[model samples]
Target chain A: MTDIRAKLRGFVLEELVYCEDPDTFSDDEDLLEAGLDSLGIMRLIMFAEREFGITLPDTEIEPDMVRNFNALTGWIESHRQ
Target chain B: MQLLEDFLANLSSHPRSCCLVEGGLRLSYREVAEKAGGVARQLLTLTLPEGYPVAVALPRGIDATCAVLGILASGRCYLPLDLKAPRLRQRWILEDSRAVAVIGHAPWNDLTLPWITIDTISPTPLEPLPLEMENLAAILYTSGSTGTPKGVALSHRAIHAFSDWAKELVSLGPEDRIAAIAPLHFDLSTFDLFSSLSSGASIHFLPEGLTIAPSHLTAWLSDTAITGFYSVPSLLSFWSWKGNLSASPLPDLRFLLFAGETFPTARLRQLAGYLPHTRLYNLYGPTETNVCCHWPVERETLDSDHPIPIGYPACGDRLYIAPRHNELWVQGPTLASGYWQQGQLHPFLNEEGWYQTGDRVGRNDQGEYVYRGRLDRMLKVSGHRVEPAEIEAALLSLPQVIECAVVGIEDWEGIRPAAAVVMQQDEAIPTIRALLKRTLPTYMLPSTIRRLDSLPRLSNGKPDLVSIQAILTR
Candidate 1:
């Protein structure tokens, strides 16, 4: 299994924030509050699935996930195999 | 029915005014009529069965709207075919509508329909057709993101009712210059263009793909001095995302109409704090019923639990919700001709003539209906039926929650419901994953709780499901 949690953290930094490192972004940082917009979220979804081969189902695709790295990782960990 | 003709006659009176603006082109009512007349004369020459659809697959602009009017003036129903989408999607629309003729700047791709290019001839002024109230005018194809797009056939009387109803609500006149923001193919823009022109109100067209960027949007709003504008909730929310309403907004902007999606009460409240002086309204309708209902979102209503009320029917419109469900059944003078090609996929309404809107709605004591969500969005869990909207509502009720979506994911055994959420920055993101469990049952808990920086929205400003589906497909 791909480390869904670690992969999600990396996605937040890479696809979402373009952050230099995942450590800088917290699990709670508001994607909207931290300057993430709709366009950015769209790109993230495309990136996360393609990069990690993660098939995000509709129920799992929350609008809020992009708000923070911690939230993204939490979702991955909670649904871990 | 005489309004279109009267507007044509009054075209002579507005000589000095700039009527339509696209790219480098600007046309007065005279110029518009002249160019459109040139097209209409040629279209009138074509020998097609009455009610045969003529599709216009092209970029939206003054030319596109003119093409539509010309097709109708030639006594044929105009079918809008946007060239920007996938060609396959366009082909599906063509197959469904059985269009006989297409007017576009793009090269004719279809093997069957005759393509008519209007720029070939010099301008000739058009004469108004003797149109009846029941005469078929235009059939608009809506983005059936949930299913295949269907054509909504509207009549002259239905069109007239929509225009007059809007005019009554806004009390607009020749003095008001409305800006066209929606793609001509979108149902909301249908009203924006026709309702404004229903009277002699001048229309200002935003440049193609103009509002895609924020800097350009603010500049265009300022440059055009637009008095009124219609947009989707997602678009409006985007403008206010930075919470910059007090910043140099369009000084002349007054009436702001939004439709084609659900508007969360929280976002509306935030908008009120920003644009305190402007009037915001939520117009409701399916493509099938042009805009049958409306609810004016005043600053005061923002305080209610669910402030966005889909108000009373306009003109001869009626709305009745199904018992214990959110689906609203509508019957009105302005209803469309039914899905393209597919005559009767849904007869859920009744012999009395009400069409069921798959959306869920609730009525308050005043008989005002508040939209709940889609009926199908409710999912069946392990021996339990649950509404994702309920969980979403609970999430939003929490101060930390910003926006959310719930979907049901199937596993090896059965199905599980989950939620994706966007949150405010001040809150710890990791904590929320654990926090939501308290508010929801174990089975009801989202299997995954991903956060998004932003949500993908459709052109109509509703959430984009295709983009969402792409994530899962990947």
Candidate 2:
């Protein structure tokens, strides 16, 4: 689980370009408030789906569920095929 | 010619028809007209001089729309300011326009001008004020290179000319329900508001929260049964990339019109494939000209990798291509009154009344006018114009900043403002960003902030743009 969280954090910072530092974001902090817009959210979803072979539906990824790093990871884990 | 007058006539004819849908409220033409009349009556009570600007600093909703119409009904131009915009930017607009009064529900205390509440205004029977077609109707502000917002003053005749041509071209009617995607302050909203209102059609305001949320935006489109829509290319690109448009096909959507920035070909193709039934158009113009040209995107044009042509001039507009570089110059009744700075006609306007559009164009293989790019240093980031100098000036104002220069950095995604600062050695990127957020809008804020010993200088002692670009690119 820790390995998955770290990988997600790295993907979000470097690939998705959410923010400069992975450390800037806490596990439970809201990503949207931390400068992640809808476009960024889309990038996250796409990146997770491509890298982890998950089929994350756009309709299912509510803003509330993707509130933070942990919530995003939780969604990704449950949705992974 | 008289746009406001014609709109009032349309309102009276369709008094009981649904005119505006916003905030869980459906307001009919009668209700809207009465509310606008109340605003007009309250505005008259102020006894401001006719033709003076009345700033409407309200949130986007039915009330804001009524406030603007009321200002027009009272024989004065309305200057709509987005309440969510930075207070500094809003203040600059209020001061620059020299507005007589402000009317809105938003609480702003910085203004010396009198304020009127929109919801509390009492209704009164107002006689039609004799407003001329050539008289000023609205002033929309765009980002300026000099760190100040430049107001584009547009007249009633200009908007009427453009919107009439637009309505006829789209075949808009009372049965159509248009989605208001752009904010009231942006020039694109003019067509969304006037075209629908003039044709006795309904306008459904896309709530502010839904604008950035693509999924929500698509959901709203389905729920509202919006037949017509107008927006910038960036939003459409967002929807194409993320909104899952294929899964949620909008059966009621008839057409989608876009402007303000170049739509990426990949996303355009994606959206086209997703929505095969909807007609698509690329409308092009600066805020000054107000929808002077349009291009209907056909299947062949959509398949190409090249940027779509902006197409020919709309009715009542004359386009001149200068021999020097095929620079686009426009002359028409649709041209804006002038820039609001110093109350004089813009320097871009010639004695012959032709406004030089600063946009350079070239003919594609098919003889269509293809957009080359802007002749100026202005950059469009997500449809909002960002002048690097504006961000640099804000950075320099910070006490810790010694020197700074901003430049546009374009990559695969799009252009973003990047800053190279010669601040105190201890200052960091996050610190500079935090300081800038207080004054600049999020779009205007620089994406990349780098500390530098000093900005690269040319032989002329000016900041070397080429060198800076090389460094930023590297």
What TM value does the first chain of each candidate achieve? 0.60, 0.80
TM-score against native, each model: 0.68, 0.91
User: lDDT tens string, model 2, B1-474?
Assistant: 366665677766877899999869998887888888899888887877555689988766798888988888888888898665668778877877788899977557766788998879776544558868988888888888887778888888888888888898889999999999787888888888788899999999887556446777898899889998998787788688767687899999999999988988888999999888999998888888988888888766677687778887785788888888788989987899888874333545888768988899877677677889878778888777778888888988898899888888887567877878898867666666667766777677776777879999988899997788778767
Off by over 4 Å in 1: A1-81, B143-147, B304-307, B324-326, B342-349, B377-474
What digit string (tens of lDDT, one per residue) describes model 1 on residues B1-474?
A: 543664565576775566677767878778877777777887878777666678887666777778877877777777787554446567777878878788877556546777788557458877867777676677776434333455667777777777778876877777788888776677767666677775677887776433334445666777777788887766666555432345666667778888866666776787777666677878887666778888887677678756578877766797787786757888877776555554222323467677877778888777887776665665544323356666676567778888877666653223445566778986755456445544444345554566777777888987665565344333
Give fnat for candidates 1, 2 and onward, in order: 0.00, 0.15
> For this target, which candidate reaches the highest DockQ against the unseen true structure?
2
Lowest lDDT sum, 10 consecutive residues, model 1 chain B, at B340-349
lDDT of 1 at B464: 65
Which residue ranges in model 2 land beyond 4 Å of their true spot? A1-56, A65-73, A76-81, B49-51, B342-347
